[model samples]
Target: MNEHQRRLLTAAGLTELRFDAPMSECCTLRAGGTAAALIDVQSIEELRRLLALLTDEEIKFLVIGRGSNLLVTDSGYSGAIIRLKGECNALAVQERGPDFALVKAGAGCALGKLVSWCGGQGLAGLEFLAGIPGSVGGAVRMNAGAWGQETGALLFAIELVDKDGRIRQISVDALRLSYRNLALADGELGSSILTAAWFRLTADEPEQIRSRCAAYLERRKGKQPAGAASAGSFFKNPPGDFAGRLIEAAGLKGASCGAAMISPVHGNFLVNTGDATAADILALAEQVQAEVFARFGIRLEPEVKIIRDESCQ
Candidate 1:
C-alpha cells in the first residue's frame, strides 16, 4: 500500500494497519516472511469500505480467516492482507423449529467455537468437524469436511461481497459445493469474501451431540500429530485411495528436510521441528510426492495453501 492509500484507510475507520506484518503469525505452519500491509476490518461496513477503497485504487489484497490451511513461503506476499473482526466473529441462533434450527455465524467465527456452540445447543450434523481448525468463512469457501460430513451439507445460505465490492446473498445450491471445493458461477475461487453463513441443523440431545463430537476428536487425536506446528493434512485423499496410505507405503514416513518432517504418526502431515522453513517443507512434500508417484504410479496433490512471493526464487 502506498502513502495515500494508508492515509485514506486510516481516515476511513481502519485503525489497525501494520507495515510488513509478520506472515508467520497468521498461519499454523509458522513460516513466512512479511506482507506489505495487514489490515483488520472490525465490521461488515468497515470491510465493505476497505474493499471499495482497495478496488478503486486497484490495490491487490487477499482476505484471510483463521489461516489454518495456509502455508506462506519464506519470501512473503507483497500485497495487502485483509482479516475480519468484531461482528464477523459473532454466532447465534437465528430461528428454531420443532426439529431443526437455523444458526447464523459470522465468517470470522472460529470453526471450533461454532461447533462447540452447536453442541451446546444440541444441534447435530457438525459433529464430524469437531477437531478441524479454521474460520467459518474459510470452511465454507473450501467446503471443508472430515468423517464424511462436509460444510455444504448443513449450509442453507451465505452472504458475501464479490471482488468488485458488490454485496449479494446466494443460496447453498448456488455455491456448487463439492468435496473440498466451493466455486463461484464463473468457477473462480477467492473472488468473493463470505460475510456470514446460515446452517440448518437437526435438533438433538446435547449429550448425544457432545458424545459424537468427542468421538470424532478422539479419532483425530489418535491418528494425527497433536500440538505439532503443522498445517493439518498436507494432501487430499485421492479417488478410492488415501494420501497418507500412499505416502506411508512409499516409505516417506518420518522423512525430513531441514527441520520439516513428514509426521511418523501420519504420513500426510508435515510438522515443523523448530526452525523449519517453508522451502524446507515444500522440498520434503515434493520429494514425498515424487516417491509416491514413482512407487504407486499416483501423484499426490497438496491440500495446504502455499503462498509465495512472485519475486522469490
Candidate 2:
C-alpha cells in the first residue's frame, strides 16, 4: 500500500483492513483481482469525510454501488475503493401532483427493490426498469433502461457531491442522457458523486403495475440465464440491431476462454463457468467482438463498465 493508504488506515482506526481485498467479493461477476484498499462508508458524513481526506491526500479513488454491470481487471485497481453499500440506502415517496408522486431514492438503493416498491404503490414509470440489477445511482449514471424506457426520462433531478466535497443539485435537462451515457462527464478527476435522485411517477392500480413488472420479469427469465455468475448483458444493442443476434450469427455462442463462456441461453451474456477470472471474460469478449465485426462489419460495444489499469497493456 502507498503512504496515503497507510495514513487512511491509521486515521480510520480500522484493524480489519485487507491489503488486497478480492474483487470477486464485491462484483456481480465474482471475478477480478484485489483493490489497493477497500473502505466501507456507512453514512453521508462518513462518505463526505472520506472523500475530503482522499482529495487532501491526493489519493485516487472510486465510489462503487452494488457492483452490478461492472468488470474489474485481474491486475486490480491500484487506488482506494469506496464502497457505498450501507451508507446511501434511503428511499421515500414525495407528493408532486394530485395523480403524480416523486420517488426519492438514495444512490445505494437497490434498483430492483425501488422498482418493486414503486410498482407495489401503484406508481407507473419504473416498470421498464423492473429487471435491471444495479443500484439507483448506477442506473442514473448509466441511464439504465429496458423496453423502450430509460431512467433519465422520469428523473426530475439528481444530487451530487463534486470533487471538493461540495454538494450540488442538477436538473434532468443538464444530464445529457443518451443511450447508456449520463451527465457524469469523463476525464475529470473525482468529477461528482451521485447522492440521490428524484423520479416522477403517475398513479395507477397496484395490481396493474405489479402485473406489468411480473411480465417483464418473466420475459427476462426466459431470455437470461439463471443461477449463474454473470454480469448481465455483455454488449449494448447496436442501433436497429441486437448484439445477441449478431453474436449468434457469428457462431460465438458457448465459446469459452479459461472457463468464461458466452452463455448459450443468451448470446450477449458471458457467464463464469466456475473459477473464471477477469482475464478469461475479457478474452472471450475480445474474441466475440472481433468475430462479430469480421462477419457483419458492425462493431460491438460492451455495456459492462471495466475498471482497471488502462496502462497495463
Candidate 3:
C-alpha cells in the first residue's frame, strides 16, 4: 500500500484491515489477485469516515456483499474493498397492519438467512430468495431474481451512503429498475453503498411459507449446478431467450480452458473445476459470448460483475 492507502485507514480509524487480501479467498469463484486491503467496517460512522476519505483521495473501491456474483481479474484491485459487518447485518421486523408487515434488514444480511427469517416469521413474498448466495445489498443493486420474482418488487425503501458520504433514504419508486439492474434516479449507477433496506411483506402461514421456500431451493438445486465453484448465471438472458439456452445451442457446454469450464448441467454457469485462474474464467466467458453472438445474433450480457485492475491497463 502507498501513502494514500495507509492514510485512509489511519484517518478513518478502521481496525479490521487485511493487507493484500487475496481475491481468491474473498470471492466465490475462488480466483483472482490480491486487493490492496479488505476492511470489515463495523459501524455506519466508520463507513462514513472511510468513504469520505476514499472520495477525497479519489480511490477506486468496491463495497462488496457476500462476493458471490463477482469476478476479479488476476492483476487484482489496487484499491480498498469494504465489507459491511457487525451492526450492518442486523434484522428487525414490525407489524404495519392486519396483513402487512415491514422487515428492515441491514445490507450485509445474507439473502438465504433473510428468506429463512421471513419464512419463520410467516412473511410471504421473499420465498424466491431461498437459495440465492449473496447479501441483500447486492441483490437490490443488481435487482437479483429467480423463479419469476425480483428483489426490487418487495422493496419499500433503502438507506445508502452516497458518493459524498451523505446517508440518504430513497424509496423504491424513486429508482429506475430493470432486468438485473437498479439505478439511482438522479445519480450515476453504483454511486452509493446500500446500508439497509425496508421490505413490505404480507402475512402467511409459517408452515406454508417454509414449504414454498423449500420447494424453490429444491427446484434450484435440481436445475443449477451443485457444489461447484461457480459465479452463478454468468450471462444475462437476452430478450425472448435465455443465455443458457444459447450457450447450449452453440455446443459450448462442458467446454474447458485451463481449469475453467462451462458447467455441463447449466450452460450459464462458468465453473472452476479446481485451480482455474481469473484469466481462464474470463477467456471462457469471452469465447462463449463470441460463439453465442455468431450463432444467434444476440450478444449475451454478463450478469456477474467483472472487476479488472485498471492499473494493469
User: What ranges in model 2 sit over 4 Å off?
Assistant: 13-19, 184-190, 310-313
Per-prediction RMSD in angstroms?
1.5, 2.2, 1.4
Model 1: which residue pairs collide?
A: none
lDDT string, candidate 3, 182-229, tens digits? 887876566589999999999999999999988998998767889999
What is the lDDT for 61 in model 3?
Answer: 79
Clashes of each: 0, 0, 0
Model 2 — TM-score against the truth?
0.93
**How do all models score by TM-score?**
0.95, 0.93, 0.96
Q: After superposition, how far is residue 144 of candidate 3 from its true place, in Å?
A: 0.6
Q: lDDT for model 2, on a 0 to 1 scale? A: 0.84
Ranked by lDDT from best down, the candidates are: 3, 1, 2
- Of the two candidates 1 and 3, the one with more favorable TM-score, higher being better, is 3
Better of 2 and 3 by TM-score: 3
Q: How would the candidate models be sorted by TM-score, starting from the highest?
A: 3, 1, 2
lDDT of each: 0.86, 0.84, 0.89
Winning model by TM-score:
3
